[model samples]
Target: MGHAADRRPGTRVDRMMTVPAAVSRSDRASATREAILNAAERLFAEEGLFAVSNRRVSEAAGQGNNAAVGYHFGTKTDLVRAIAHRHNGPIERTRARMVAEVGETDDTRAWLACMVRPVTDHLADLGRPTWFARFSVQAMADPGYHRLMAEESLSSSSLRRALHGLQASTPHLTREVGEERREMFRHLVLNVCAVRERELAEGEPTRWPTWDDTATGLIDALYGLMTAPMTPIGTIRR
Candidate 1:
């Protein structure tokens, strides 16, 4: 048997200390990563996504090592995806709840609300001075980064369900017209939200009083756009 002195609590205490030490390092790394993500999103939103550099992001994040971005996130595209993912989870949950509420409905406005409200609700939950809306617009506008945004968006099962519901509600639209209107809806929502986000960030008055109102306006406009009569291709003069 070991002597009492040899078996004293020193070894046990030392072992216990290791856990918190490891946790502290992990906490610090996570905090650093968050900082880098916030800085990168803001920079990307303010400047064009292609115009901003990883080194600039790191510097804005207050990292002394300019390579901190590259070390934490592999590439610019990876960093943008990470920023998107941070917000996507909450938005997805909200959309899932909305979809559940309006299950298998042919109501066009209901489907449009499901598609629009989740996003605006998320923005509202984020409070003012958010960068995500602007960052998303920048990503969607860029050819190189557009696919990344689309992939992240399509990965949401709730969004897919909402879109299917929308399509079913508007059976009058031919496949080509449906596709064209879908693009229009995407541009309208993103650009409108981006404008609202910029105005909020700049402390300027917004055209719509609230996010809910903005969502309502979008749904109304989309309903008109989707239900509009299609012009015959042959009737147009080239």
Candidate 2:
């Protein structure tokens, strides 16, 4: 009779019911971490990274325990890195696909498009009132936290590939000048997106009606910047 019970359909149902206890605990923990990340990102974006405390993030996340941020992410730096990692994965994947589609092209605009669109597209997909662009600008603006953003970007092979292609397409630039323009490009994208994000969040009118339009305008500007002739150093008025 016990052997017969073990073979019954009801016995399988009983075994399945036992799994939810551990799964539920895990799901709850995951949900808590997500809430904390979302809260931390918004606070850090709006109030500046150093100005916001772990305790504040905890409360903002609706966690009764003030130590929740530390409990899940170890330190504030760790929490910031976690936030970066969460968004970086999707952005990187998008860039990789774009890179693959464009292949090894000498087209500067194509490479620049690959660089700019992934970020704007990701922001667009995230819908209105997204915090990541502002959060990224804040992170990059901080001397201590700037390396975190650089490291996250340098880790992406797709970004590296796109940059290499962009540089290769512009054979006229000296290595020094190329590096300078690269820095300018980075700042332009970051600040533009951050401003657009702020406008959207605050219900203000935007320069571009949509993220795609913004990307198009950015790519055009970048193309001109990249292809523009450099002034001769001997002709300087200074």
Candidate 3:
């Protein structure tokens, strides 16, 4: 039976609310839990949550048995959350700090950059954890997984709030234009992120694509088309 089955069904509510009485044993248990989470994060990123087994996570983490996953996190969903929390925690802190610094500034660009850069920079620096990135892409493609991710570690409200703040600060953005343009921009950015792993596997990137490169050209063309209506379309049409 899965570790989830072992938990009493609906009887014990509010698990996180209970503070375990401090004891020497519990301290060791907590440390073991952290190690498992760390190992899970690394392995999950490389092998993907679906591809990796709990046993593998246990072994990678130096926990000799599968019970470690269940001992710390009751379900796979909980494990995913622990991984996301670790990955996103620093980015969240950096974003908060950036927001505070940009709070009094009149620049919308800075605010927007602050909002987008942290996540992208982390992914770029770390290189997509193969497993995690695959899982993310798969989740995006599959409705059930998408919902699972949304329920577990995802929140759209904060991103929406950031966009709203940018709209408020930026004078040129009309409601319709901002909504359309921002949506397209975000979609493009996400595509770039999702494709990075594939790009790395194909070969080393040397320079920016020449105009002949279809992918780059297509994106550039779409960017221009999307922005065209926002500015002087008639003058530029000819």
- Estimate every model's Cα lDDT from 0 to 1: 0.93, 0.93, 0.59
- Our model 3 lands, by Cα RMSD against the true structure, at 11.1
> What are the C-alpha RMSDs, in order, of all predicted structures?
2.8, 3.6, 11.1
The CA lDDT at 15 in model 2 is 67
All candidates' TM-scores? 0.94, 0.91, 0.56
lDDT of 3 by residue, 192-216 (tens): 5556554554565723342123234
Candidate 3 off by > 4 Å:
1-31, 104-108, 123-135, 151-160, 167-187, 194-238
Cα lDDT over the full model 3: 0.59
Error of 3 at 79 (Å): 1.0
Put the candidates in TM-score order, highest first: 1, 2, 3
The alpha-carbon deviation from the true structure for residue 108 of candidate 3, after best TM-score superposition, in angstroms, is 5.3
After best superposition, candidate 3 residue 149: deviation in angstroms? 3.7
- In TM-score terms, candidate 2 sits at 0.91
